[model samples]
Target chain A: MYSSVSKGFALLVLVLMNCIMFSAKAANGITVSTEINFSAQPQQCVTLHQGRDCFATILIQWQRPTSQTICLFHVNKKQATSKKQLMCWPESKAGQANIEFESSDNLTYQLRTQLDDRLLAETEIIVSWLHKNTRRRRWRLF
Target chain B: MFTKPINPNIINRLFIYSIVAIAFFIAATTHASPEEQSLTTHGNTPITKDAFEWQFMLDMALVNSPVMLTDVEQTELWDYVQLGLLFDISYKGFFLRTNSRRSSTILGGEELGYQITVQKDWQLDVILKAYIEGFDPIEILDDQNKDIPELVGLNNREYTSGIALRYSRYFENAIFYIDIASARASENEQGHSATGIIIDSFYSYLIPYRNWDIYLGAGLTYYEKALMDYYIGINADEVSSARPFHIADSTFRAQLEVYAQYPLSQSWSFNAGITQSFYSNSIKRSPIIDKNKLTQLMVGVLYVF
Candidate 1:
């Protein structure tokens, strides 16, 4: 009866730990030791014309000193009021994701703690253009 | 032996061919789209690499004083609604482009060409384009089948397309272009073809004002004897007392244009333009020529993709 009671206690502990991890409530369990470094490859998206939508496959990477649960949010600097959570990861030290991005304006990719929504690391995708007018030239040769 | 008669509306066939070329070129260029785009965006982005790009536009315009009429009998002012679908497709070093304008639409205004070289601010290209648009008298008559007195016996001038070498210089707010072309006309019913040499030059300046781009441009064209004679000259056998046999000489024509474009959305735009063309004495002296000057006004909406 004592062994069964010990097993039940262990099961309950495991369940509690899982709940704490998933619910992002491990605020006192572990602390970030060092700075979180985040970056995105192909940092700039370029279109042929100024008004065209720029498209690119962005490679997002982040590294932390210790394993921790965090989520990524995409924020458009033009519309600061709206922020979208792209993805979240279970306790991990380093992670990378490939995302297809298409937008007319610049976008910011941010990494933050899921528990307190504290900003950790952020990178920006700069949008640029080659020509001012979209291929519609006024060549009126009569 | 019976023979097929020549169609006076041969320019329509040429326009249709140009439309087909636009479609074919657009399809061909799209084959090198994103799949072939290199992902070497490391430091700085190189804008024009080995890329395939396309833009499709639908343009409609209300034109005043159409230039298609060559008759001396019709003196009343007439208005016309012109519609055109234009396309620009580029791949590697070649491009096919079309422009929709009031006077040029009678024969499809297309430039099929390959970019030979692009220097710091200069570009050179080899192109195939139609220099002169043909006119159909039947279509211009009061009725479809009725023949106008002035055009009863006049032979229709067939549109001419030719090889051209174009040189362009880009400036901060303007551009200058010069073209030298050897235009070739299709064989007539008499089994004879004509070739003419032409030199054209134009300058366009852009003015930016409150989300609108206004362009002021001027152009000059030098036509050779063969082209002028074939289109405007009257032949001996087909000449009457009213239209005596006459020969045309090489001439220069001048034109001025003011054009503006406003963007309504990311993919849509509105454009309006006015053009005035003045003929020289050489062109005015042609037996069939009616007017010394032509004026046109056009407004259009464009959707780009």
Candidate 2:
């Protein structure tokens, strides 16, 4: 019984270890071939403080579309109201855009390959007004 | 105007146990927002019963004093982290994945289990896993409380695979849970070659206010003879002048817990819990055992992405 249990435990631990290791090291390797980095500053809000303006600064960045001009679409998921607008066409291989919303909600953005609105890549960021706990601290006595 | 008052009886019990002892011992750790998942919704339905949903929780607790003092007993505080991940895929009431969702209040144990939900009422779980000792005897560096004779003869524990069955349910204002497990001894480990059984059950009520949330609970634990000896027994060879041979039989443990979380923002919250556990005479009689009751507390922040 002991031997069998030991073997089983070892096997189970091995499987869990594999899951953890793979999850840590898998698909995160993004190729330079395609990418879109979208982020928002003040990603969240918790107070009526932080200066009354409770909104987030949205950023949309992607590799410049080589074949044609690309347009950007901001999909508001909070209220289900999505809008499309021309962002940037590739004058160069790299492109960047910064936009801000005065409200707080979840937002998604898509980059299109051409003015015809061929979708290429999409990303999202959320700006919230919920109260947030403070950051944690770690110290070592030894 | 929203106000939720904690039951007076619970407050009295919390006071009786001096649960506020760890109220000031806050640690710097963070759990994400979903940890506040006191509400579960299915499809387009309004707030309904708790169902298996996608959940990711990371809970960290800094215990000020080590309770299970089996090894290197000089440590003043210990850190514990419990991570849970559950993803459910279902369509038309048929769950494609094993509903692996549970509320975590037990110290720490791993269960490779599957759940069966009963009409969104009771949840049952069956688990099979390689067994490891639940009692942890840690080794701390630069030890301070070294030379304590009662901390001697502490050996690494042995374990084998085990089977556990758990049942739990969420009520209107409280959650009820229970679990039982039987263990098989590892063949190579000598003192632990006996089979054992354990039973535990708890009930906790939730009180939600505008910004504060409280969970008060109480529970009982029973360790069968084989299980008690595996953990609390002292071998003849390990017996010394300071540590005598101690044999244990079935034992019982009673526990009271109070946990609270204050959300400062939608993304950040402060969480804390104090648990006091009392042991039976069988365990308290061990020569190496010094405390009959142990109290642990943890307070930290939470960050949700």
> Which has the greatest TM-score?
1
* Highest lDDT against the true fold, candidate: 1
Question: Chain B, candidate 2: TM?
Answer: 0.66
For model 1, the superposed segments whose C-alpha errors exceed 4 Å read: A1-136, B1-15, B22-50, B68-79, B100-107, B142-148
iRMS values for every prediction = 18.3, 15.8
DockQ each: 0.05, 0.06
Off by over 4 Å in 2: A1-142, B1-53, B58-61, B68-110, B128-145, B159-161, B185-191
TM-score of 1: 0.64
lDDT of 2 by residue, A1-142 (tens): 1122343465456445545643432232211223333223333333221122344445545564454566677777656656656467554455676776553444556676665666665544433332221110001100
Provide the fnat value for model 1, as a fraction from 0 to 1.
0.08
Give lDDT for model 1: 0.64
**Stretch of 10 with least lDDT, candidate 1 chain B:** B1-10
Listed per model, the TM-scores of chain A against the true chain A are 0.70, 0.50
In the range B157-217, model 1's lDDT, one tens digit per residue, is 6667789999988887788888899987766664545789989888889876544678899
Q: Which run of 10 residues does model 1 chain A get worst, by summed lDDT?
A: A24-33
The candidate that achieves the highest DockQ relative to the unseen native structure: 2
